[model samples]
Target chain A: MIETEHLQKKYGDLVAVKDLSFKVESGQIWGLLGPNAAGKTTTMRILTGFLPATSGKAAVAGYDVFEQAEEVKKEIGYLPETVPLYPEMTVEAYLSFVAEIKQVPKTRKKAAIDRAIEISGLAAVRKRLIKNISRGYRQRLGLAQALIHNPKVIILDEPTIGLDPAQIVEIRQLIKSLRGEHTVLLSTHILAEVTQVCDGVVIINEGQLMSAGRLDELTSAYREKDGVYLRLKKIDNEILNLFRQLPGIDGAAQEGEEIRLEWDRNTDRREEVIKFCLDKQLGLLEMRSLALTIEELYLRIVSGGVEQ
Target chain B: MKAIRSIIKKEVLSYFSSPIAYIVIFTFLLLSGFFFYSLVSWFNSVSVQLAQNPYYYQQININQMVFSPFFNNLSIVLLLMLPLLSMRLFSEEKKMGTEELLFTSPLSVTQIITGKYLACLLILLIMLVLSAIPAALTFIYGNPELVPFLLGYLGLFLLGAAFLGIGIFWSSITENQIVSAVLTFGTLLLFWVLSWVGYSAHGLWQSVLNYLSFFEHFDSLTKGIFDTTDLVYYLSFAFFGLFLTHSVIQSRRWR
Candidate 1:
């Protein structure tokens, strides 16, 4: 539904997006994960046909952003970083105006506005002026306007920024409900948001693509070794040595009260370790497999520890 | 066409929803009414004196004594007031970040510009119509030439359109409404004073400057002379302002 190839955008001597390439399949939720100033907003603006790229190409819904901007615009909905709204307009009036500009047919305009209002949970405050609404409702109204036209592709820049915890959860749930219906490309610096709401992620830093893939695939691909963490009571050097001497147990180290055991990727030594702990009279409190999380993966990629 | 209509509707609604439209219209009507009252009183006094002498009575035409100066004063009032109307057309969008909504939508820049221009023009039209209430009173008391009175209004509308064009262009180039209003006032004031400056020049310089001055073109129209040159000048000046607005907006997208 959305694709970009070597999409570079330069503001005079400063490069905002550098040769960035990514693709989003139909009906899939993909997160553009990056820190601030990572060119996420610039990429989105180019895709939405708001800004002309200095070089390269981007297409949304099979329409080239540069050559066929009107068509592309008709096929996509965009919510910019700051929700653009007229404070003087009522919520319903604002949505109606967006539907009109988005070219919703007159016969169905009312229905469209109602559906957007319903989806964004704006039914109660539809008649209230925008300036009088709270911040959370304003954000929802922004989303409602973007969804007013029911475009094939929806691009949101920092959709959850500046929201309270409850509002953030509500917005994430709203986005998750959109899965398999509309192809969503939302950018955010929050790692947990991507992990919770997106099927895949394209991580970038400093205007460069660091990594891109499904959540599980990325975690496994970045894993260096198979390991398990065990918390056992009454731990001692003698028992630690005995555990390290076991077959397939390549390394064992004590991290405070817990024991970290490393082994070959294909080995399952957890059972053996549990048995060993029982025999040694060390009370095993808890045991779990050690795997890289999306948070760690994001941190590793953004901190320049890994190159992809 | 539908897109332009929608934008126009929204612009008009926004103008009315705020206090700006009512304030501008009220102030314009009050000022124009005051001018009409003072001018008519002076004309009545002069005509009474001239009634004693047939020769002086011939010199006391109401069009020259009242309507011409009335139209000129309204033009200056428009010059001051039209900037307030156009200052927020584009600059407020930029300030409130609604330019993103406008630019990202399917509407072209031309459609957006036309919608806003016509909306402001509509307000100017409404003000002109209301100011005629006092002018219409002239018909009740004295016989004023109909053609020059209407032509004077045409000239004011054209002049207002030109001022709006310049104001919209300046609004497009900045995000600050005050800056847009000030720049528009400065540019319009320069054009208003150009003929005064031209009086000191000689030969070709004099003709060129006078021709370029908006006041010179407006002067002939209020005097009841209909010339295509003045029409073309105001229309082309308006077109030139809109053209510059288009270029500035389009260029900013690239930057």
Candidate 2:
């Protein structure tokens, strides 16, 4: 439901978002992954019509963000990084005000507010002033304001920034429950969140698009690093050379009695390695598949250059 | 229209939710009431003494004895009070970071500004309405002239609205409510003094500065004179301030 082409934003001599382009499909949970100062917020702001792009074009829900901003604003719910709350207002009052401003029909305003409060898990604190609530509840209240009108797309920026672990899990579960019902475009510095909750991932660094695709497709490209680790009772150059010559092995690294073999995800070098060990009479102590995590892929793409 | 109404409703709710509204209204009423009564009693003593004397033959009415000078003092009260009413219009939003909510909402810059402008105007209207309590009490002593009394209040309302417009613009330019309040008072004081400064100049320059003074138009209107030029000046002053507010808000969205 979101697309951009050469979307660039600059503040005088500083380029905040540069040559960024990505697309998010409807009803999909897409995670925008980047480090601090990586232009994720700028891109999201442009898509939400809060900030105009310095150049290029962006559209949300099929409307040009700059030209048809009001319509785009109507179709998306945005939870900014800071939560942007009126601390003096009660939770219910804030949600209802959001409902009114979002133009929810008068007949459905109460129901809409109720639905958002229920979804954000803010029923108990509905009567409490926003400033009196805990940080976790405040974050949820921010979510409630965004969801009050039930916009087609939900955009959240670092939704779990300051929350404790349990609160983070609760909020993550809440986000996960939105899958396939509403299109979600969320940005976070949490990499494991991308793997656990996102249907697709878009990795960006330094205001540039680094890598983006389905989660499995993204990790599949790094299977060469997915290998088997082994520790043997004995070590020799001849045995190391023999193991490196195995048919399924892509490469081998030996440090004293320990050996690690690298291969693609589809390769099964375990059986071959065991047979060779038996044949050579070398005692094998440990062997297991070392899976490559999205974090590693992220690090590789960020520090190892964008070629991957 | 719905957006504007929602904005005004939220602003009004917010205004009353804080002690600032009560304090502003209370100060305005107390100050105006004090001045209104003292001026009325002073006028009463003067008119009484004049009636007893044979040397004074100039005609004295309630409009001349009470409304004219009381309204001028009312303008001074407004100068002290209207800034407090409008100081938080945009500055608090900016300081609290709630402008993100306002700027990103479906409402346009014009809608947001118009809504806020009307909310501040409503506060001034409340103060004006409450000031009428003192005005109505004047009926206990003498018959107040209808046209001049009405026109004087009209002048105060217009002048207060213009000052509120300027206050909102100043609030938009900075995130400090104190700065906004002080800057508004400073600017209004500058306008107040411009007419005094016109005394030293000669010919067209002096006349032009006097015409440009905010109180000059207000003074003319309080005199029961119906001049479209005064209306034009007040309306344009308010419109220009609001237009600048809109520009400040719009420019904020870019960087």
Candidate 3:
């Protein structure tokens, strides 16, 4: 639904986005993950046709962003980094206005507004002024604004920036509900939101693309080479030495009662280790494959490598 | 059409929902009303004195006195007030970050500009209507010729609209509403008084400055002369102002 080809954007001496290339498959929930000033919002603005790239190309819904901005805009609904809203308007009025600007047909405008209000859980405050609403409601209103026309592609920039935990969960749940129905490209510094809601992530830092892939693939790819962690009831210097000598185990480290076993990637070591442990009558308390958290993975990806 | 209408509707609604619209309109009406009363009082004094003089040799044209002072005062009022109406059109959107919503929507830049320009023009239209209460009262008290009066009102509309276009352009280039308002005032004042500069110069320089003076062109219309040149000048000036505004807005996309 979205693609950028070596996209670059510069503000005089500062480059906001540089040689960014990524593709969001149709109906996929893609997270644009980066810390502050990572060009996430810049990339989104370019894709939404608000800002033209200094060089290269971007397309959303098969429409070129620069060449066919209006078509691209019609296909994508964007919620900017700040929830751009008319605070003086009531919730219902705001949504209705968004519907009109989004080109929802006059006949179905009411229905569209209702659906957005319903989806964003804004029914009770429908007639309340936006300025009087809480931050959570305002965030929901921003989501509703983006959803008013039911565009195929929805780009949300830092949608949950100032929300509480509950509100963040609600917003994440709302984004989850959009999966498979809309191509959602959302940017956030919150790794938790990305881990919980995004199917894939495009990680960037310093205006350059660092990594882009499925969440699982990227996480495991960046997972430390710890191999596996094990807590055994029966552990000693001799057993640790034995583990080091095992067929699949490349090395072993025992810290008192706990043990970390490193092994070759190709081997099925769990069953072998289990059989060996059974033969040796060793007490195996717990064994699990180790992986890095999304935060750690993102930090490593963004900090450790030169962007490709 | 629908896009522009949506923008216009949003803009007009915002204007009413906020106190700024009422404040601006009230101030304009109050000021225009005061000017109207003072002009009428002076005109009435002159007419009554002339009527008492049975041997008066010179004719006191009530129509000329009625329109010239009224419209001239109105032109100054519009020069002062129209900027307030146009100041918020683009500057507020920029300041509040709502320009993102406008620019990212399917609406083109032209739609946004035209919508805002139309909304500002509508506010100016309302101010004109409110200012006309004094003139409407004149019709009830005495007979005032309609054609020249109507033509004078048209001139005010054109002059106000052209100033609004300039104001819109100025507003687009800045995010501070007060700054936009003050700059608009300065620019319009320059054009309103540019003919004074023509007084010190000679030949082409004088004519050039005079031609650029909005007051010089509007004065003809106020005198009941509907020259195509004046009409074309205002229209083209307004058009060029909008064109520059479009360029400014469009250029921001690159930055």
Judged by TM-score, which candidate is best? 1
lDDT of candidate 3 over A225-308, digit per residue (tens): 547777877778898888888876888987556788877655558878878777887888788885678877876787884233
Query: TM-score for all predictions?
Result: 0.97, 0.93, 0.96
Off by over 4 Å in 2: A230-245, A250-259, A264-266, A270-288, B54-58
Screening candidate 2 with a backbone cut-off below 3 angstroms (N, C-alpha, C), the clashing residue pairs are: none
Order of models, best lDDT first: 1, 3, 2
Write the residue-wise lDDT of candidate 1 on B11-65 in tens digits: 9999999999999999999999999999999998998988999998987889888
Better of 1 and 3 by lDDT: 1
| Candidate maximizing lDDT | 1
Lowest summed lDDT window (length 10), candidate 3 chain B: B54-63
Instruction: Fill in the DockQ of model 3.
Output: 0.80
Q: Provide the lowest-lDDT 10-residue window in model 1 chain B.
A: B56-65
The segments of candidate 1 whose C-alpha lies over 4 angstroms from its true place after superposition are A266-282
Tens digits of lDDT, candidate 3, B1-255: 998988889889988998888988898888878877877788878877888776662576656876877788888888888888888888998998889998998888999899989987888888888878777887888887788888898999999889988999999999999999999999999987889999899999999999999999998898888999999889988998899899999998777
- Model 3: pairs clashing at backbone N, Cα or C within 3 Å: none
lDDT of each: 0.93, 0.86, 0.87
Better of 1 and 3 by TM-score: 1
- Candidate 3 scores an iRMS of 0.9
Preferred candidate (DockQ higher): 2 or 3: 3
- Chain B TM per candidate, please? 0.98, 0.95, 0.95
